[model samples]
Every structure is written in C-alpha cells, then in structure tokens.
Target: MLPSIIIVNYKSSRLILDCLHSIYRQGQEEFEVIVVDNSDDEEGRKAISGSYPVVKWIRMEYNAGFARANNAGIRAATGDIILLLNPDTLVEDNAIAECAARLRSSEYVAAGVQLLNTDRSPQITGNYFMTGGLNHLMALPAVGRLIRWLGYRLKVKKTNVASAEGLVEVDWINGAFLMVKRTAIDKAGLLDEDFFLYAEEIEWCSRLRRIGKLCVYGDLHTLHLQGESANDAFGSSGKGYYNLSDRKGYQIMLSGLVRIRKQFGAGWFIFHLAAYLFTVPVYLLVTIIRTLFLQPGRKREWANWWGFSVNVLRICGFVPVILSKKPHFYKVL
Candidate 1:
C-alpha cells in the first residue's frame, strides 16, 4: 500500500519546497504528497503546484495550527499509510518507503525514523509517556536530576528503546516523521483539534498505544530543522536554550498542560498544574540570584523562566476550557 505524506505548511514556503525536493529525489513514485497550506499563500501554492502538479493542496482560510491542518490532509488521503511530515524536514534516501514497509510488515501501528539536525547529528526521535507528574517533576532542577538518576538506576527507558532489528519501541514518536497505518488512525481517530500546536502528538499517541505498538527505525534518518516552521510563523529572537520566554514557548507549555488534562484526566492534570504553580517562586528566585552574581549574561535565562512561570499561571485562566470537550483554538501567537 502506498503512503500518503501530509505536510502542514505555515508560511514556510521556501522550506516546504526544499522538503518536497528531498522527498521527490528519493525516486519513490508510489506515494502521494498532500500539502495542507495553513497560510493560504497563493504564490507559494502556485510555485509548489506548478513544480509538482500531483501534490494535493488544501488551503485553509486561516492558520489552523498543526493538528487541524494535518487532520484536513488526513481526511483527504487515500493511501493505506499516512505520514505526518514536517515542512522543514528532508527525508534521507528511502526513509519514507522503508518506514512504511516496516510498519506494514511488523506489529507496530505507527513508526518514526531517526531525526537528525542539519549537521546530521541524531535528534531525539522517540520518548516514553510523560504522565504521573513526571512532566512537572522534570522541570525542577534538583528533582529532575534525581529523577533522571533514579530512572537510570532502574533502567527506565526514557527515550528510544533498542531492539535487535534496529527498531525501538517508544511511547510516542516525534510528529515530524511519523508514519502510521491508515487503519490505526481510523481506530485511534484524527488529531485532536483542541491542541493548536505542541503535545497533540503525545496525546494522540496515548490513544494509539492502547491499540498496538509504536516503534522507530533507528537506522533510517531524516533532517529536521527543528522549530524552523514555527520560527517562520511566529518570529523568534534566537536566544535561550529552549527559549521558554517567547510566544512559541508559551504555546508549548500551555498545550502541554492541555495534553496532561486530556490524556490523564483532571486529577493528574491538577497535580501537575499545582506543581508548576508552586515552583514558580523557586524558579524566579533561583534565576534572579544566578543573573545577579553567577551569570550576568543569563538575564535572558531569567526572563525565559519568568515568562514560562507567568504563562503557567495564565493557564489557570483557561482551566475550564481545557477540561471541557468543547473545541477551542489554543493559539498563543
């Protein structure tokens, strides 16, 4: 069965063109490409469509976010396998076809390949479920280190799991290069529209995990220019390690809260929310102290932590909407 690759475009027209070039260069002619243009860039559509007339373009009236746009593409897909690819990524060699073949032959319901940075270094592709207050605890400096050490001592697989066949069983794979059977998606349902950006894939994987295994082909690789598309949609300052101060970071933290609420229910969600709220002062004090004496140039770091803390509190305002099943756009940008 051929795979239908769905790429959600958000003002990254040039990047999407390069991504398409990489895919077509693979010479794998059995697959179909669907470009869900959230920006509705007529010029980009004309440029891309003019080059690849076979591409199925679905133009959105507004920036519909990742989940909604991909859902639109998925609804239009006719292929047996569906690949949710990022517009900023370039598939290496036969990574797409090989990933599809692996999913078709194995018991895995969904699969992701090894993601690489532009330098070809491996990026984090798969990870275990972030539940049970683990997400909240991991944000704390000391507790996070202790938890990691304990996890290491217990051999708790946090990221990718190694197998003899070069496939790793993971809780969820990055959405940038995820390939899943159309039947599995039919069972698990489409991407939840409530999530405007981040953490939607993890929530979707939570449901997909209930049905079958999810794996990653460790050998297959794809170059993912991480956050390039987001940087295009919402301008970035290009500072900080995670840049949690920016609008993008705010959306990420907020959507993560939503994902916790949706996947684990209200109790765990409340626990995490309280944990985050409680740690706000601690993060603030530490950053303030570090910025004053230890690292003067770390003002940006302090701002990032402060912004993240403020956004966490802001999430409190949206708790009612987060808990409800009602559809809402959680766009921070």
Candidate 2:
C-alpha cells in the first residue's frame, strides 16, 4: 500500500466524519483513511461506522492528547507513507496526490504538506525546523509580540511552501496536515508521547532532520479548521500553558535530547529553575489579571504557569530534549 491517511478524532465527530467523507469523495488517489478516536465513549467510532463504513476507526478509551494518538495510528498504518491530518481539516482533491508526488520525487524529504484555511488561503504551519529557542526568542514576550505580529500577520504560508514547484529542506512541519514517510517515522520513532497537547511535531521533526531535510510541496493544499484543536478564542486564558507549553515542551526536549547534565554541566539547569520558581507565581498574577480583566473564561494561562513551574521543580537532574537555539523555522500559510 502507499501512504495511509491517519487522523485522530476527538469530540467533533461531525467534523471528523465530514473530513473523512471528503477524503473518500474527493481524495484523488488510492489510500485508506484511519481514524483514531480518543473519545472514550466510542462516540466518534460508532458515528463513523454507521455512516461511513468504508473508513477504518480505532477507538482509545481515554483522551490521549495529540502525540500519543498519532503514534497509535502510525503503528496501525500499512502504508509506506502516512498522512497525519486533523479531524477539522478538509482535503482537496489533489491533496494526497500532490503530497505523494513531492515525497516520491525527492529522496531527501521525510514528510510534509501544504495547509490552507477555510478561506482557501494558505495557512501558517510554522517551520520545518521546530525549536524552543526560536519560539522563545521571536515570541519573547515584548519583542516576540513584534515577531508574532509579522509571522501571524505577514509570512510564508503552507500552500506556498509545500508545493511541487521546487524542493527545499525544512526544519519542522505542522502536525495539522503533515505527511510523513513511514520509514521516517521508523527512523525518528513515534511522536513523543510526553507532549500531551502540542510541540510533538517539532520534536518529531527534530528527529526527521537527523535523517534528511523535510520536503514541503506548495501544490497540494488542505483546509485546516483552526479552532478545532483549541478553544474558541485564546484570549488571555489560553496564552499561559500555550505559553508554558513551549517552556515545558522545551524542558522536555532538553531532558530527552540533550542531558541537562551535558548542557548545564551536572545540575546547572537549576539556576533557570530557581528563577522560574519566582517567575511562575508572578506570571500567574499577571496572566490572571490580564486575562480575567480583558478576556476571561476558562483561560489556562495561570494553570499552565503553575504546571510548568512544577516541571521546572522536577527536571532538576534530567537533560532537555530540545535546544534553546533559534532557527528559521517555516510558517504555515
């Protein structure tokens, strides 16, 4: 078999079924759709089977976040290449064909794809190279505001980057509409299950970079429904863990990839931890005041700050899996 389409479905059973049906109806190639539903109730599975029996559905009794679910789908996949798509994305007719052609034509590429928004414009999926340093440096609170302004406002998009028109090696690709070579996954290992929500792709892409450059073909395009994976509006509430996600993610990266003992020289990463100890509380106060006053709700900023602080307290002796260097990672359209 060629590359199989692997998608993890959560509560949006309606959207999930719609996404799969679109592939079945419009996918212009030979492929199978594997839906790994993290919904414990089997709600998504039962719904898909009743309507779209042709699609294969895998049910996990608990919500396994993003990385673990993809790992499950990859393990069950029979295709040489695997397309990890989000349940809220829409596949264009040539999406699969374009991805296949790009990967098949180039031996250097491991996996990637073009992503678009509902308006049919390219979506920004970040860079092929994933990093905490770049995210931290560019998105460094005050100065990062400017970088985010440009990146989120004006930057390269998924459609323009992942086309077949030319071939360029990239650092990281977005997991939203990512296409991966099965061999690449074999080489890189499964998505790091530690990332309960985000940064798993960056971690995987980091491994892929070790193998070869990741290819992004702009010709193939898919529509990504942004809010599907996150809350309706990030506002102030979401900014914190979403913020801490990177911090914690970086710490995980550091510990997993580069031993803290190596980078900080035997318990040196602790200085940063001691600093975070104070900052985490301060961050909660600021985040809560900002979000609660400005854009309130179930915002998780304080929660994330608290969570990240706990990790900083724990990663006292482990190495970080990710480096703090900033590279020109790609942007999704």
* Winning candidate number (TM-score): 1
**lDDT of model 1 at residue 83?**
96
Local distance difference test, each candidate? 0.81, 0.60
lDDT of 2 by residue, 1-333 (tens): 677888887667888877877777763547877888776647667878888776788787777767777888888889887888888888786677667766866685465556776777666653633222233334222334555677677663432243333444567777787887777777778876655555567667767777877766665677787655444211222322234343434433333323222223334444334444555566666677778897787566656666555655554433233334322121111
Considering summed lDDT, which 10 consecutive residues are worst modelled in model 2? Answer: 324-333
- TM-score of structure candidate 1: 0.91
Off by over 4 Å in 1: 130-133, 136-165, 237-241
Which residue runs does candidate 2 get wrong by more than 4 Å? 27-29, 126-132, 146-166, 232-333
Candidate 1 lDDT tens digits, 1-333: 578999998888799899989988878778889999988699999999998898989998888899999999999999999999999898888899888887898899999998888887678788787546373356453335566788789887555433213777888888988888988998999999988898889889989999899988888889999888887666875522255556776787688778888888888888877776776776777777788888887767766776777777787898888778577888887
How far in Å is the alpha carbon of 200 misplaced in model 2? 0.6
Candidate 2 global CA lDDT score: 0.60
